[model samples]
Target: MELIKLGERTFCADGPFKVGVYILKEADGYSEVCIIDTGVDEAAAREIDEALVKAGFRVSLILNTHYHADHSGGNRYFIEKYGCKAYSQKINAAMISNYDICPSVVWGGNPVKEVLNNYFYAPPCEAYDISELEMPEGLSIIEIPGHCIEMFAVKTADEVYFLGDGVVSVDTLKGHKLIYVYDIDKQLESLELMKGLKGKVFVPYHGGITEDISKLAEANISVMKENIELILDICTTPKCLDDIISEVFDRYGYKLTMYKYAVEGGVIRAYVTYLYNKGELVAVKEDNYIRWKKA
Candidate 1:
């Protein structure tokens, strides 16, 4: 992982999955070094620790934007090393502290041994509920849920916003074709909210930092709308969930692995829920099979 200094107060540890961990430099030395998100495991945390040391800052606190392994996997390492306080949104704090709940929720049932691996679940760590605390100085926690249950964006006084999977990069959208969202309705609303953000720079977890993210936000919304329409078209014949998933994947020619299957299932289910709630689709029982059809 390469740590690129973004500003006097901001630094990014660039890796396969980038994380924003900012430091507050003081005249005497460094006052507090705050971690926005940890990478997948201790390995990522090691790099972050190195970056902190190089910047002459003592680790003060670690904040998780959500409970996903890629975002909070280094919680144990940071907490054990610095004895720092960890904080996250209420729902995410509860899940990260437990750990098992993440994979369980992802698989929609008790996860098998394969799904319990570090890729799906990280080591448990304690986190304070951020909703209970007053907003920290020089930082504003913006709720940007939907990609995960309680994902948030952190805006620093430096005018850089650490967007936690709130708005995906254009390249990610083009390559993956479909992004994950637990709540499609909220995800769409979050995308719209992101459009009005005013900041000097935006740092996406998986994308490069940029001054403007409006184009990327628009691209993400376009993909969601396209996929919803595709699913709606396929549901004209009262298809089952698996059928809708298959049709969409086949149309996009996306090969699936066990992990991808689980992730995509949640994404498809979100679209289904949105359509059902909007009265654009309805669930039907035919021949003991549950299917969805146009309302």
Candidate 2:
């Protein structure tokens, strides 16, 4: 088990995954553990469990930084094994409770489809049996909704921020041939917030690690602008989400992957949604589809 000692009483699960789990050791032969995020599966749970045993800390609680599968996938297992409560932002709670696809990765033909699908259809809502956040707890929850709505970061003692997929390293994003979000502007706003942070360590979800978040934030913004320009240069006519995605990505010869399709739609919708909010675009809510056009 890889346990990284970060300052006093704080340990991070360093390599393989950058998810940070904080440990608070008490002098009277007791300890309190706050989990920032859970990794892919059971391996993560056991590894973390071992780390806690070594640190002599009791797993009192596990708080998901967000609902992304990489972050929240192991919630049930961890909570059950350790008898600890689990918490996430309200929106995330809704996602977990509703079993939304946003937090769970769905690749068609993946082996876990049946398991994931069954989990989705399981009895009543998934139990959210954990306490919410408070400043006195030494973790400040900042709501940054963009990449995923109801997104948040945890600021541990002395300005250590755990940005949950809010912003990512440009290079890491580029490798996927795309990044994702439902609203680019909101994502940009979220990134802007990261820039203004006083914290020295910026733990972005996908990026390995970053202390100079301002530079990373600015670079992400620049990429967004470039993508926007490239997209707009060709979207001369009014187009729907699917049409834009097929044209922009397909025309560019980029692999029209499942994640890419979602990203392209999200990027277009972000612009459209932003315009709608500003009264520049008009949106009419239909039963299953919402129509948007220049206001």
Candidate 3:
């Protein structure tokens, strides 16, 4: 991957998932870099390391947006290799230190062996709570929790905001129809927050860099509303959680795998919870099954 310069000190290693590289200082004749988020795996981290080394930079710190494998999978690699410090929100730091929590939470219990791969379980690494750490000069954290618990967007001194999946590209929405979210209400609030953020450029991990994020934020908000409506429509006749998930998969043409069942299924459940809490949907227990129906 190539590091594309965004500002005087900000650069993004553009790949399937963008990794933010910010030059903190030049020390010992090498540029000291603070990585916003490491990519999916060791391989991704290795590529980033090579790119940074080629450019005469050394990683001194990693600021994880959240504990998702795709975002923090390379944490151990960087910390072990460079002796770099890693930090995240308290809850995320705990998860990053013990990554099995990820797949277990997604599966709602002890995860089966099939779901224990890198995508679900990141290699564990020690990470301190960002709140307790002294942030490097020019780096600031913005709380944008929703996509994941305690996710934060980093704003560089150059006014470049590294949005950690707070908003997805329109194409990502079109491809997946529904993105994974921990809390629907928080996700919507974060979308509104993204619109009001002032930045020279905003970089979403999934979405490419853009000067303005209004359209992208609106698109994400629209898809979330649409997904909610779709769920409400499906529940009109009353359906069990499994039935709703099956119908959603059919409507979205999602290929069912163990992984998608956990991830996408979780997204549907979040929408269901949002609607139920809003009093638009009601839960009924009948014939040994709990079903949801339009209220």
Candidate 4:
């Protein structure tokens, strides 16, 4: 993946997920750089290294926005190659260090061999909890969780916010109707939070860089509400969770593979939980079957 220059010191590498890598130029010729949200594998890490070498920058540190494989998969390569300290929030740091917790959480159980591959699980790498680590001068960490557990956004001194997966491109929304999310309620709240953010440019991992992200955040919230309405409409009668997911999957015309099933099923469950919490839906066990129905 080629690196696209975002600013005087910032660059974005396109990959399965757009990776954000920043180079902070020191007074000396030796530049200090930070790799944010490594791509899905070792090759992605290599690409980032190559880009840095070509630009005459040295790695000083690495940061992970969350524990997702696509965001943290290349942590092993960077840590081993440059011996740079990796930092992440407490929960994500634990998941990254453990590694297996990622696939297990995503699959909601023991993941199959295929799901255990690099696409979902990465090798363990040592990382420090962000709270314990010293925030480098001029950089601030923003807590923006919703897409994943305790996902943090890196706001550079240049006013460019390296938003992890808090927001995605519109094309992505069209193609993948259900963006993988953990808490729809928090997701909505975070979107509102992003709307009020003061930044010159915002860069989402799966989207392009823009001066304003309010519209993008709004689109994400709208799509989430649409999905919620779909589930609510289908729950006129008590419907099992599996049935709800199947119906939503069919409506979106998305393929039902193991990975898709796990990810999409999780999103569907989040929708149900959001509605249930809002008192718009009720969960009951009828005939030994756990189902959700409209309140």
Candidate 5:
């Protein structure tokens, strides 16, 4: 992983997943580093540690945007090795400390063995409530919820924004037709919020950094609307949730897997709730099955 400097003190480890690193100089002639998000596992954390060590920095704090495994998976490593202070929103902090809650929530119950891998369950790590953390000078947190519950975007004094899955790149949108969204309505609101943000550089977790994020935000909004419309069309004929999931996955050429069924299935359920609340779709319970149809 290459550590690319964004500002005087802001740097990012650019790799499969961008990890934000900010340096704060202490009075005792020591430089303490803050990590924005840990990557998928211990290996990713090791790479980050090596990169930061070679750059003459040591991790002292970790701020997880949310409790997804890919973002919080390395929390255990950092906390164990460096004794780093970790923080996230209250619920996310709880889930981070109890990693199994992640897969259980995604699966809507106790997840099976197939869904309990590193992708869903990170090694457990303790985290405090973000609200309780004392803010360092020039570091601020922005609440950007949509992709996940209580997700945050970190802004440095240098005006660099580390957007935590707020908006995805056009290439990512094209590659993965369906992006996971916890709340479709809130996701749209967060995208609108991002357009008005002033930043020297914006770093999205899954995409490259850019000076301007307006176009990227618009691209994500467009894809979200398209998914909403597609789901509505699929409901033109009354269909059960399973049918909708199958049709949506097949249309996007996604192979059926237990993992996708849990993750992507949750995304579909979010759409269903969004459309139902908007009065665009109606649910009918018949013969012990609930089916949805266009209103």
Candidate 6:
């Protein structure tokens, strides 16, 4: 399909990028265009350009909303083919560009889903060597470290906050009683920042967009706070990282070994860290296992 125009200079594409692309239509020609979030592979990359060609917009600069493979996967292809500059958050530069970062571990992140479900896919990206640039106008980023080390959201002029995964859409939130945010506290804080937003709409990449983001923010916060309390209650003894993880997952009726795999070790530690930071819990070093006692 051609451009799914959202505004005078903006458009969105599907399948590749999932939700779509944000096109800054070039006034000069096709060469001056700015695109935010290139979709998955070479095929998606080509379609983005082809659609631009059809719309008479030239591709010039490409900005990755974050370093996730799904968002920046096409950066290398775009820069190599179009000579467009590639950009991402300064913090994630090494992780996304290094060849050693095998992101496949992030999927089927829970062991329960890993055993019950066999859904898997190859890691679709290689290192993308983008000459980084600062974020552009109408695209301010706030560090949301829970989802990953360097997660952020891109806000547009339309009062639409293109939050990557800081929060899921309300539609997806409707059925699930518990939401699996790796860093529950930071995710909560991120949602807090979003709660203050005057923006009437939110466009998260994964589960589609939402309107009146304040409402979704409220629901997510309420449910998550309750989950945290429940997890704390279940912690009769301090267990190893994996044991705690498994315990928490099983409580939610989730198999820790399935669906998704890479739950952040540092972030998991951060969950306890958050509780400690909040003065609600205390951690004591035991000989073999760390004992966490609620204060």
Which 10-residue span in candidate 1 carries the lowest summed lDDT?
A: 22-31
TM-score of each: 0.95, 0.78, 0.97, 0.95, 0.96, 0.75
Worst 10 contiguous positions by lDDT, candidate 3:
111-120
lDDT at residue 217 of model 3 (Cα atoms): 91
Better of 3 and 6 by lDDT: 3
Residue pairs with clashing backbones, model 4: none
Candidate 3 achieves a global lDDT of 0.89
Which scores greater on TM-score, model 1 or model 2? 1
Top TM-score prediction, candidate number? 3
- Candidate 2, overall lDDT? 0.63
C-alpha lDDT values of all predictions: 0.82, 0.63, 0.89, 0.83, 0.89, 0.58
lDDT of 3 by residue, 188-234 (tens): 99999999898899999976578888888988899999899899999
Q: Please give the range of 10 consecutive residues that has the lowest summed lDDT in model 4.
A: 18-27
Which segments of model 4 are wrong by more than 4 Å?
A: 25-28
Poorly placed runs, candidate 3 (over 4 Å): none
Off by over 4 Å in 2: 27-30, 100-136, 251-253, 262-268, 275-295
lDDT by residue (164-265, candidate 4, tens digit) is: 999998778888879989888888889999988998889998766778789888888889888988999999999999899888888888778876777778
Write the residue-wise lDDT of candidate 6 on 195-279 in tens digits: 7877645766665556677777788788677656754775555555566666666666665432323543333455666776787
| Candidate 1 local distance difference test against the native | 0.82
Report the lDDT tens digits of candidate 2 across residue range 192-279.
8878888767777565577788888788777777666655554444455566567666655777755444445556656655665766
- The number of clashing residue pairs in each candidate reads 0, 0, 0, 0, 0, 24
Which 10-residue window of candidate 2 scores lowest in summed lDDT? 116-125
Q: How many backbone clashes does candidate 2 have?
A: 0
Over 109-156, each residue of candidate 5 has an lDDT whose tens digit, in order, gives 888677788867887878899989898878999999988878999999
